[model samples]
Target: MTDKASPGYADIAAHYRRLIEDGSLRPGDSLPPMSQVKEEFGVSITTVNRAYRLLKDEGVTTPRPGAGTVVSERLQVASTGAARLARIARTGEKYAPGETSVDHIAHLRSCHDPQVAEILGIEVGDEVIVRRRVFVRDGKPAVAAFSMIHSRALADVPELLQPQPFDRFWQEIYTERTGHVTTKSPERRTARLASSDELALLSVQAPENAAVPVLVLVNVFHDDQGPLEVWEDVYAPGLWQVEGEKP
Candidate 1:
């Protein structure tokens, strides 16, 4: 049993969180292993696991595929929808907070998922183009977005097939390429537990006997012709929102 005065998981998690925030620990920095941390803190491995899990949940640290858990390369920042749109309008880039992305991915794939097809206003089993991107802030995986475009759109905007970030927001690219201006983008929000693949992608783990929940934001872009694309953004858990104080 841990001594009554011994440090707990929160203490450990906070210690690392502060270090990462203060630049004492830089991005891609490895955190001490459970065994080492257990010895230093005089706690069991379980305690260390809990602490690490907490840090992951908060996006302070992330699990690298071949490497162990390390300080996240980005941190998530939450802003109003209007604010996000304004940023995208002024800067052609989305995510990276304006930094060059090292992991932007775009690909063409067929869609058999009915949910995705309905959102795109197409029949089930229709083929679509998928663009996958992981948005990082401060150094953590903030959001993973999958943009599904109908194959027909590619005849006009072939740039969507490129495996990288576009010079401008994709919607703008669509308009300039096909003159199909985006009239509205309606979004739906939901939450669900992360899957095994998601856990790895987000670089976070769930607590013992429980799974991490992700906020799913699905946006369907539409123009005069009809639905253009469906963007599904999966947000990591424990995202922080900035609030303005009343005078």
Candidate 2:
């Protein structure tokens, strides 16, 4: 869940993302040189330049005259994930219908992405449902989210899919219908630029602030039944705040 992208430049960007995520690379940390990457990955200067450009475009790195591409000192949103969600909910945006402006759409279970598989603790081709949505506030795209519910948990609750789709949260509906106590909720946060998929889901134009920052807050809601829902939200620039935690 770090900056890990696909292969090639994506791989390189992922490496930096992991470094930052793991606290190995902090804000103002100098990334390795192109020559070093050339020596390490045995790629051409052009390829390294492309990778660096991608990171720069993603606002993970910035170029300076005296210094090279150093990590940008961004606003670190270090608050607890629940705290952030509670803050949003307190703003009258719980993301529920009538309570908030969100385009909620549910998709059939897919097993193409490894991240999805890993998140749901299922095989690569197993069945899992995803909810894709974009939350609008003040008529502007404020948040984009994807919530995955393992189909195994829904096998007994077939009514959840019927009657023109439930308007409430999946977790709430599940607990209400089955009386499952959703106990554990552990979460973490990360920052990255909105990808094309995220942008399309949120239906937003690109990069108004020279850097399109997305604050990703991922939380897994669970009970005795193991993870019931794995939800990840990517927040737009203004609607999300960034702060640091005391050590």
Candidate 3:
């Protein structure tokens, strides 16, 4: 373990990296016990320590006096951006559920985007139900997303308008409406500097990394009939992991 970036150490570090990226290992989530990880990876404690040290140096995970190694509270988006958001969308995901609350919900009828109209198989300007909400973490805006549901596709499933967890409830509605499992989807994420309007919307207060930038993500869930929903999300700087897996 003389070299912290040795092959074994890198391999171990990479494993944990994937878990964090996929949103499977969320912020403040503890890494497995050293003994457990050693047995699983068939590596010595020195190698594990080296790997853990590397993660800490990169600011992906942190070493706590009593908590061992925990994932960083500052969001770590996977370089493969859309997958992370898709993971959350499919599972109603949250990093710190106790501290995360959805609020400022605005439901409106509009056909705002031509791309959305095409995806939902509606004529441009056809009405759609747009649900906009903000996810606040520690009383600050972390994520803001707009869920545009095709009015025709959402036909009869008014439950989406309620306050329940959207993932499971939406699945139930999908099965009830189409008599089949919900369709799979594709997602894309683009990183950019946070604009004034976005900054105001996020209402950022003392960001962890002032240099960190924002990311715009487009997620679409569709089937034969049309897209069930189209999501455009804005992830505030220092609060999301949009940087790719390379470094």
Model 2 misplaced regions, further than 4 Å: 1-99, 159-168, 207-213, 242-247
lDDT of 2 by residue, 110-166 (tens): 677787578678888877777676655435565676777778666756644442334
Q: Considering only N, C-alpha and C atoms within 3 Å, which residue pairs clash in candidate 1?
A: 73-139, 74-137, 74-138, 74-139, 74-140, 75-137, 75-138, 75-139
Q: Per-residue CA lDDT of candidate 1, range 1-247, in tens?
A: 3556778888877666645543467788899888988988898899899999987876667999777899877654333233345545544335323232346677776788898888778888677998887766656666676789877788878888898777667778778877887854544668888777666666787665576777777667787777788877677677753211111
Please, what is the TM-score per model?
0.61, 0.53, 0.66
TM-score attained by model 3: 0.66
CA lDDT scores, all candidates in order: 0.69, 0.62, 0.66
* Higher-scoring candidate on TM-score, 2 or 3: 3
Candidate 1 C-alpha error for residue 205, in Å: 2.2
Between candidates 1 and 2, the one scoring higher on lDDT is: 1
lDDT of 1: 0.69
Whole-model lDDT for model 2 versus the true structure? 0.62
Model 2: lowest-lDDT 10 consecutive positions: 91-100
Per-candidate clashes, comma-separated: 8, 1, 3
